[model samples]
Target: MSESKSAGEIRLIRLDRIEVLNPRDRGSRVFDEIVRNIKAIGLKKPICVTPRFDANGAEKYLLICGEGRLKAYQALGEEEIPALVVEVTDEDAFIMSLAENIARRQHHPLELLSGIRQLVDKGYTFKSIAEKTGLAQSYVKEICNLLRSGEERLIVAVERGAIPINVAVTIAGAGDNDKAVQAALQGAYESGALRGRQLVLARRVIDKRQRLGRAAGRPSTTKHSQVSTTTVIRTYQDEVKRQTALVRKAAFSQQKLLLVVGALRQLLSDENFVNLLRAESLTTMPKYLAERVWPNGSHV
Candidate 1:
């Protein structure tokens, strides 16, 4: 390794010498994108490296950041990559890994969590993690939550770019651990599983399935009571026609009633009818009414 201004600190190294810390950093698509960008525009940000020792008092460099870009450079058969060399402890190295990732925004959800977990396992609390990485406390908690998802498939999905980090965070907190596992494995949940306000409903589906399994052993009393498809259809058709006929009859009756009411209201308002009624009331009844009252006496 070449020594720079500082005697103990190595200044620069080959791109291949730096190692990626997080196992989940297998960024196939991002690497491809980086390669494409490099092909079009070229590398913009330099990678971060830390100092290490080899046998025989020799020095080496371990990559603390820019894993995706490094892979892209490697794919392009790059001769050199700009790097920063610093001497840091194992704990600092772990923090530096996550810090660089947060700074560069290169790691996936799982990779970010895996890096955070390394720092956590190294005795860093959420606060310490935030301070070291310059991330907010809420973001630190979110990263820890992402790591706690525990579903291998979900973790894989996050690594493979199948799901967004925010949705994965929600899925991690949701119930039905088995379904979560299934989602993680399948890279997606079943229909209606991820809908808003439908998580409880999804649980109901699981509950219903379980209830059906329990009922599978009991003899079905409904077997003998079941009607044939043809009989059911015929019965439904007959009922429909009967209801339709009743409706039509009722409609006709309503029309007749309305006509009779209209005729009575017209007669009540007529001047000739009113005068005839007044004359009949003064001991000179209508001829038809007089004949009915005195059937044999008057032929009016």
Candidate 2:
């Protein structure tokens, strides 16, 4: 340790002597890339730490940031690594760490949550966290609330980009009411966050989950022989053919009906044709047909 240097000075520090105050589970892929970068070009930035002493009066360091860099150094078999030494209170250390995590362009989602959690556990307000991390105060409050309330699934979904944060928040407050969830989906559609195809799929998934009582598909205990891909494709093709035929037949019927309605409307407009129909007592017709033929007047 450089004993004579003031705060914010860079120096070499032994890895064993430093402790990571806010250790996060870095994603393996990201960590491997970090190792490769440091191994290739050396560390671009030094890890930041605050100096302290153990019970035996031996000097030590509490890690403020740069956990990836430190771990990469260890992975490369380096005993000591460079560090940015800072002198600050415990709260200040936590704030600085949060800032560092926020500044990182490629950190894991859970790592972000971990850093925010540490700050919250230290009793910093959401406003303070927002100011330090350059996030909206509402965003800070919402995420911290999720962390405190044990909404782990929602938090992970939002952080990992599986779901929008607002959507998760709506779900969190929805409770056991299906109506609320539906309304939330409606709102997402109105806001253009959920498109038509996504909405259709979402509803189908939700309905399936409700009917089947689970989120994931399981192996069927009452299965017959395995379905061959060729058989499945044949069945699908047959269904498509059947649907196409039905659609064409319905369209042909629609055109015939339109001609019939148009002829009926023209005939009914003539007083002589109307009198003949009345005299023959063939005056009644289906209400829908009547509406199409004589929309304003009631066709007896």
Candidate 3:
């Protein structure tokens, strides 16, 4: 029998020669950024690859890591780049892919979740996934808990970047993807307030209400359906009057207490005020005056 090749003995290969097993095509922005960087700095990192053995026992190489980088290099029409052709089992190949993905400078939480979930689906436990991927088991558990939250469509949306992962997790836990999706779709489809920040706020509000056992619906009580200008004006006036009343009430209460303080101070003899001031070690006249002016613990 031929000597089995280990990972260390694997050889470097040309960039264009290796075939990509899996391709990520969702985000153009990521590809664009990679293209820009490669154009500026050139290839600084080698794509991790695995040797493909044919039915006839011929050796071929396939890309395992740097899938995006390989595509970018091909697009740039580079002749050859550095690569590591490691001999690996299928399990080790999967683990290596996971490791390379996690070490990326920017990681999409949902993408990471999906990759780990795939490994788990392939008969790997959270423990094994963590060990191979260099992620903690606790992190794996936290992410896996999301799938059991019973919102498959929301999870898909999160992975696709249509919705944020943080918000998706909350919506998943709320057990009402229909309501959340309907609200989001309508807001984005109908209303002009379909910002990412607004989606995050909506998810936060829904999660908060769900946790508190309260109804999770539109955050604002008023509906977006149109009403008469007269009704709108009336509502606006009512709100203004209500706020004005509160402000006046607060101002009057403060004034009453100030008047009481002034009367109490006047009632105190000047000699008593002077003696109280001398008793305390106040550094400034205003501080001494403030201390002498107020009665101790007496409700105004």
Top TM-score hit: 2
lDDT score, residue 114, model 2? Answer: 73
TM-score of 2: 0.60
Candidates 2 and 3 compared: the better one by lDDT is 2
Off by over 4 Å in 2: 1-7, 196-300
Tell me how far candidate 1 lies from the true structure as C-alpha RMSD in angstroms.
22.0
C-alpha lDDT values of all predictions: 0.58, 0.75, 0.61
| Candidate 3 Cα misplacement greater than 4 A, ranges | 1-12, 55-58, 152-174, 177-300
Best by lDDT: 2
Error of 2 at 165 (Å): 3.0
TM-score-wise, the better of 1 and 2 is 2
lDDT of 1 by residue, 31-142 (tens): 5778999879987877767777677666667776777777788889986777766666655565666676755454444455556777777777898778777777876776
Error of 3 at 214 (Å): 20
Compose the digit string of candidate 2's lDDT tens values, residues 136-159: 899888888767655555565566
**Candidate 3 residue-pair clash tally:** 0
